[model samples]
Target chain A: MPSLLHHPLDPASRIARLMLAEYGVPVDLEEIKPWLREAEFLEVNPAATVPVLIEGDVIVAIGPLASIHAIEDSYSPEAVAGLFPTDAAERAEMWRLFEWVAVKFNDEVTRYFIEEKIAKRDQRGSTPDTGVLRAAKANLHEHILYFNWLAATRRWLGGDTMSLADFALAAHISTLDYLGDIDWGTAADMRDWYSRIKSRPAFRTLLNDRVIALPPQKGYADLDF
Target chain B: MPSLLHHPLDPASRIARLMLAEYGVPVDLEEIKPWLREAEFLEVNPAATVPVLIEGDVIVAIGPLASIHAIEDSYSPEAVAGLFPTDAAERAEMWRLFEWVAVKFNDEVTRYFIEEKIAKRDQRGSTPDTGVLRAAKANLHEHILYFNWLAATRRWLGGDTMSLADFALAAHISTLDYLGDIDWGTAADMRDWYSRIKSRPAFRTLLNDRVIALPPQKGYADLDF
Candidate 1:
């Protein structure tokens, strides 16, 4: 069995887990406490980032693209619920949206939340900074607006089919929602899109995720907000 | 003719430019001063990022990966060049390294340089913080050491061939070198590797890059540095 080095709260890790679950691939989840600076974890990913996949002797480390590439190359079913688009133009669009979330959204929101909340708490006595959080919250609002525009125009972020782009974005947004950072009332189309995504069987595992003392927002597990 | 929305000094933009020149593709470069808040450019990329490629009606924006993917898929020669490895595992490794430099290195080092230098200069009367510059310089030294380790172990960052990994790294290093931020003396192996990359025909345009009042370092054009 492949061993996935990850943290439950990490969006990238969550996305990887969702992909594995979607594919019906069993993987051993080894939680990595990045703050602990574990040497073994560092060996797998020299950069010491999470969501490192260890498959026998070959170790695949990096973000969504690398993980998605590895999983798709090895286990993607012919036509049943694949995460990537088969058509050339659609595939390109899928990649674009995947990158938009992985880089832009991740940078503008997820990393800020981690750095401000988790990393701050881990480094004891340090509290999350209001300034950084303020910037992140503002940026997130703009990001949601962009998502609203996309969700309003297209069937999905990429196109007609569900792709890695949706999972990548939902992973980040879900994590933020866990912290009550998301304002679902802002975009009706996005709210409807989230409603559909939240109902996915693969997302159930994510809905149950808890971070001790930081219980998810009241309606986190509910299908309807 | 294709239009490229870019900031010439941006490492990612520079890399895209190099890749286009290397492939003999002609592009009309349009400078988008990100700080200027140009609505027209922002329409092309909501993220307000550079190196956006406009091919006919299709607007492909974001980082080097999107541009690289577009170039490889559309214009690459029948015989795959050493720039992007043909082997699956090797290609994955190259992509991983590319991500490291494009995202990690760019965030850690390049952003600091931009925040300290250009942004500060643009906001006249606001001096570049010496402390931030010092920290960025220190952090950059550590990054070079890591690069030295890679140079010592592999023929190229992705191993045995010049790949996108090399270009990704060189792109950032060249940008820093232009501002005299890199201390090439820190790693001989890294310097040697860079010397080879600098001599490539793809690199000539980068060497001639001028960023207004910030002339490149003395050795920027010297092939034997």
Candidate 2:
């Protein structure tokens, strides 16, 4: 059995969980606040980041990107579903969009939103700064507007076929949606896309994630909005 | 023939170049300053990132990671070399270390150093901030120390085989070295490892790369150092 060290709201962790569930691989989830840099977690990953996958004896996949790739390499070929596309060009596009969500969207939106909105309330016990939140919301609006057009144009985020790009984007958007940061009404196509993704079996684990003190916003677990 | 749009000092571009060269894939280099965000470049990659590999008609690999993966998937297996290790565990280790250099080190050292030292001087035409440079150097010291110990223990950064991890690391280190940022004397084993990489055939084109306005640091091209 594989055990995943992850945070409930971490986008990368969500992606990893979705990757596993989509491929029908069972995993034991061990929640950890990676920022805390616990001694045990640090031993497995010096970087102190989450989504570390511990599999068979002496086989550990540390960090988000590495762990995701590890799972894809192991069970993907024989699995009924794969997160990657079969075609070379489509696969390249899939990777390109994956980087967009992981690096660009992460820098511009997810990290900012988490720091200003989620981190203050949950971890630091500090007040959420409206000024920073405002700026982050503006960034989110820009990206969502772009995604709205993108979602309208394609069957999935990358192309006609669903890939890691879809799940990765959904992971980030889901986090923001949980915090009541997204304006679904304004994002028609993207909203439609999200609603479809929300109903997937892989997304069940994520939609059920609750932060105890900081509950999810309205319609987070709703199938249709 | 493949054409690569790259910036001489860009770590990701350097990594792609090294990957192609190691696999004996010749590419016509087209230098681009990504910060400019030219209309033409945006058409290919909306992110305006460098190291976009343009191959067969209609086949375009955008961004550094995507382009590297593109080259690896196409020319790798039987081209006398491959960037990935055959052993599953070793490959996992390679991806882990590759991410370390791509995400972690780039965030900590490369971006900060480039924004302060290289980008300030080259792109913005402004004086490099000594204070910011000082902080970046401190961060680099911590990472290099970690690499030094790891390099001393293994034949390569990702264990026994020379993998993408080595080139990814060399890409970033070479960039900093060109800008005269590294203290090679203190990084004994790492520097020794770098020296060996510097002599490789794939490293030749990188050594020959010259920016008209900016030359490399003292002993930058010298392998004996």
Candidate 3:
């Protein structure tokens, strides 16, 4: 079995965990606060980040390897058809949306929210910055509108087939949802899309994850949600 | 033939340009100021970002697709073996370093530097922020050290063969070098590694790219520095 060093609320960690589960690859999860920058953890991942997957002798420290692409590389498309498409054009589309959530959404929304809510508490025990939270929320709404547009047009985030695009998106959205930051009512299409991804068996562990200091929103783990 | 929408000094755009050149792919480059958010450009990429690659009907908006992977997908390994490895493990390492340069390096160093030096000029004609430039330079040195370590250990950034990892690192470094920000003396190993990459025929266009308002460094296009 592989072992993954991750944090409960980390969107990147969530993506890795979700990808592994979707691939039906069992992994032991070890929670670590990356900000602590533990010496041992640094040995495993010099970058000092979470979602460092150690599978026997192979250690994957970056997003491209620890996320969907890694699983796609390891398993055949026959076993996990929808995870990645066989066609080059579809795969290109998948990479585009996957990166949109991972890079754009993560930088504009999630990082700011995390800095205000989580990092401040851990590092300085400071109060969350209202200005930062407001900016993040505004940015979040813009991204949600984009997601709503995609959901209204396509069957899944990438295309007709469910792919890494959906997982990358759900991972980030789920983390925000855990903080009760998302207003599902804002976009009915986005809500429907999230509901479909949230109900997946691969998402069960993430739904069960409990951050002791910050409890999840009421509907976070609800299947009907 | 393909077309690339890009800005001269944009690191992401540079990566796409270099990768396409490396693959022996012909592309018509269209320079665009992404911040202007042109309606037609946004139609192809809602993000309104540069480095959008258009081949036939396919439009790749994000960096991951428009850069190295896009070229890799279009061409075969037999035609361009070293750009992307055929082996899974080597490919994983290739993706790791590629992301390290694209995401971590770009975020920590390139974006701040560009904001202070380039974006401000285009937007408000404001003077560069000394504090922001100072922080970016400080962050840049740390990344240079890491690059130095990688160059000293591996034959190439990824491993024995030159891969997308080298192009990604070179892309960011070249942009910084164009601004005369990088101290080549500080990291001899990184300097040597960069020299090797710079001398390549694929790097010719980037070396010749002169941002009209910002002149290149004295030794910007020099092969033997």
Candidate 4:
């Protein structure tokens, strides 16, 4: 079993956790404060981000993108079938969506929420900045509209089968969803898509994740959500 | 021949250009101002990022990550051999370095330089913030030290033969070098490694790049610094 150094609400960490669990790879989770730049954590990943996958004493990979490639390569391809689309074009689309959700979505929305809401709370940094949160929410609305279109049209976020693109997105959105920042009401197709994915067995662990003083929003763990 | 929608100094775009050229894949480059969010560019890449790869009449991939995968998959593996390593562990390390250079390094240093120096000039936004430039330079120093160590130890940035990790990093560092931010005197190993890479035939295109009102620093296009 690999040991994973992660933060409960970190979207990148959530993506790794979801991928590993989905592939039935058991991992031990060690929660860390990445902002603190703890020497132990920094030793494993000089970049100091997570979730870092470690096998025995050797650290394997860092961040969501590396973790995805690491997981696909290291794990049995047969077991991780649905994690990647088979068709050439679909796989290309999968990487594109994966890049968008991991980079653009996180940059415009999820990262701000985490830094303001979660990191501030943990480190006693400051009250969550209303101005920043407002801007992030506005950005979130645009992303949701785009995602809503994808959800309404594609069978899966990457097409045909649920892939890493779906997990990459779910991980980020779920964090925002937990923080009560998402207005699921306006995201009809995205909401419908979430309901289907939210009910999956791989989603079980994410539902049970509780951030010390910050409990998830009402109905966050519910299948009917 | 494919068409690459890119900007000269944009690190992501440069990475794509480097890879295509190194692999002998002829591509027609159409430079765009990504900050403009032009509808044509957005129609091709809704994320509105540069380095969008198009084949025939359809857009294939976006960003450095997608471009790397698309190139490897689409091109003959024999022609693109050195872009990836044969060893599994080395390949994993390649992705790790690729992720760090593309994401962490960009967020910390390169993007700030582009946003402040280039984008502001083009967008007619405002004068470059001295405070931001100071912080970015400080971050760049730290990154250069880390990269210097890697250059001193490894055969290449990602180990053994030159790989996409080297291109990913060179694309970024070269831009900052062009901006006259890099102190070549201080980064001995990195400078030596870069000198070797800079002299390659694939590097010729980058050497010839120029912005309207901005000429590169001394030795910017030189084979010998």
Candidate 5:
């Protein structure tokens, strides 16, 4: 089994965990408080980001891309079915959607939330400004609308197959959902897509993740949600 | 010829331009001002980021990954020798550095410059905050320090060979260098690596780039610098 240094609240870490579970790759999870500024953690990733994986002598640190690459390399195709499309075009599509969520959505949503809930607390700052939160909320709605369009057109964000893109996106959305930031009523197609992804066995660990007093939304664990 | 929708000042776009030049791929470059909030540009990328590429019917949007993927798909290997290593491990290492420069460094440094120079000017009410600028300048020192460490250990950031990582990183550093932010005296090895990259044929266009009023550093165009 490999070892994973991660933060429970981190969407990127959750995405990696989901990938590992999806591939049936057991990993020893070590919770890393990125805010604490640990020297050991910094040595693994000078960027101080989460989802760092240690496999034997190799240390792969980054976000979903690193985890996805690791999973692809370590597992047989059959083990992680539908996680990564093998076809060239499909693989490109998968990468496109993954990038969409990882970069765009993460930039618009997760960064704000983490800074507000975690960083602010550590720094003993006043609560996050409503102006920023309002902007993020609006941006997230637009992102959901885009997802609605993609879900309505393609069976999954990437294409007809459920790939790592779906998991990568859902991981972020789920984290927001835990914070009660997502307005699922904005898009039916997106909601349906989320429902499908949320119910997967791979998502169980993520859904069960408890972030102290930040209890999930009422229907966060509901499969039918 | 492939079409590239980009803004010259955008580091990611410049990196793509360098890659295209290095690969000898003919690309029709179209200047895109993302700040203009054009509908068509938004359609291609809702985030309104630059460096989006149009290859036939497929729209490859985003930064280094998309640019690299496009180059890998379209270009001949011999034209850009060793720019994108084909070996899986070597390629992964290349991507790691590419991601660092394109995303991490860009976010930490370039975005602040844009915010100060352009974004503040456009949104006149939001004056350029000296505090943010100071932080960006301070943060850059740490980044340069890390680069120095990498330069001391490896021939290139990726390894023994010059790879996409070099181009991706140099593209941003060159932009910062143009702004006179880099302290070359701090890292002689890093400076030497950069001088070699800066002298490459692919870097000619970058050397010629002129941002009004914010002139390049005194030695920006000098290969011997």
Candidate 6:
């Protein structure tokens, strides 16, 4: 059985979980605060980041990007063809959108919203700085608008067929939505897209994720919303 | 023919350039400062990132990771079998090391060093902040130690066969070396590994790169060093 070391709210961890679920691969999940840098966890991933997937002897995939790729590499394309496109051009676009979410979206929104807004308040018991949250919200609007453009134009984030890009974007958006950081009313196209993905059986694990002291927003777990 | 928008010192751009050369794929390189965020370049990649590869009509690979993946996707595996491993396990490791250099190393060392010590100086005529450069150097030393361990153990960074990990790593180290930021004396094993890769025909173009206003260090182009 594969095991995943991850954090509940981490978008990267969410990406791994979504991939595993989408591929119908079951894995044991162990939550770890990588910032704590536990000695045991450090042995798994020296970088002390989450979503480290350990499968079989001598097979460990560290970091978010690696973990996701590891899953894709292992699964037969026939079993999970939706995650990776078959056409060369589509594959390139899939990778592009994947990076857009992983690197660009992460830097612009996740670092500010999750790291500063949510993590700080949850872990450190610190007050969320309005200035940082404000900037992240502003960035989120632009990202949401761009995502809306992608959604409105295409059937999926990456292309006509769903791919890792959809999961990546949903992973980030899910976290923000859980924090009540998104204005869904203003994001009709995004809302429609998220609703479709949110209703998937693979998303059940994510929707069920709950932080004891910090509960999710009202519609976070609602399928219709 | 492919066209690559790259910046000489940018590690991501260097990775793209190296991958293209290693694969024997020639690309017309047009240096672009992403920070300028030119409208034309923004159309190529809205993120305003370098290393955008446009190959024929309707095939555009944005960002470094995508550009590399694009080349791998388009070309026959036999043509450039070294870039991506055939075995699933080896491929996973290959990607792990690739991400290690792209995301982790770039964030910890390259971003600080390039942004503070190089880009800021080049763009704003600002003096390099010694404190930031000092911190980046310290981070680089730790990274070098890790790379040395990898080189001492494995025949290549990914495994016995040279992989994209080697190129990704060399891409960053080459830039830092050009800046004279690395203390090669403390990195004997890493130096041995780098020299082998540095001597490749593909690396010649990178070595020959000259920014007239910002010349490289004395030993930058010297493989014997």
> Which prediction has the highest lDDT against the true structure?
2
Best by TM-score: 2
Clashing residue pairs, backbone N/CA/C < 3 A, model 2: none
Query: What lDDT score goes with residue A209 in model 3?
Result: 94
Q: Report the candidate with higher lDDT, 3 versus 6.
A: 6
TM-score rank order: 2, 4, 3, 6, 1, 5
lDDT of 5 by residue, B2-72 (tens): 88888777787887889888877778888887888789887777667777777787775454455556566
For residues A1-225, could you state the per-residue lDDT of candidate 2 as single tens digits?
788988899999999999988888899998988777779878888888778888765556888877888899886866455888878889899999999999989988898877766656655557878888788889889999889999999989988988999999999999999999899889899998988888899899999999878899988899976
lDDT tens digits by residue: candidate 4, A53-92: 7899876777656677787777745743757777777788
Worst 10 residues of 5 chain A by lDDT: A60-69
| Chain A TM-scores, candidates in order | 0.94, 0.94, 0.93, 0.96, 0.92, 0.94
List, residue by residue over B55-153, the lDDT tens digit for candidate 4.
898878876567778887777456437687777777778888998898889999999999999999965548999999999999999999999999999
Runs in model 5 lying further than 4 Å from the true structure: A62-64, A76-90, A118-132, B56-64, B76-92, B118-129, B211-215
The CA lDDT at A115 in model 4 is 88
Q: List the residue pairs that clash in candidate 6.
A: none
Candidate 3, DockQ score (0 to 1)? 0.49
User: lDDT for each of the candidates?
Assistant: 0.80, 0.87, 0.82, 0.86, 0.78, 0.85
Q: Give each candidate's interface RMSD in Å.
A: 2.8, 1.0, 2.9, 1.5, 3.4, 1.6
| Ranking of models by DockQ | 2, 6, 4, 3, 1, 5
Interface RMSD of 3: 2.9
Whole-model lDDT, model 4: 0.86
Residues A90-168, model 5: lDDT tens digits: 6666766777788878888788987787666666546887888888888888888888999899888888888888888
The DockQ values of the predictions, listed in order, are: 0.35, 0.73, 0.49, 0.63, 0.29, 0.64
- Which consecutive 10 residues in model 4 chain A have the weakest lDDT in total? A75-84
Best by DockQ: 2
| Residue A149 error, candidate 5, Å | 2.8
> Which residue pairs collide, candidate 1?
none
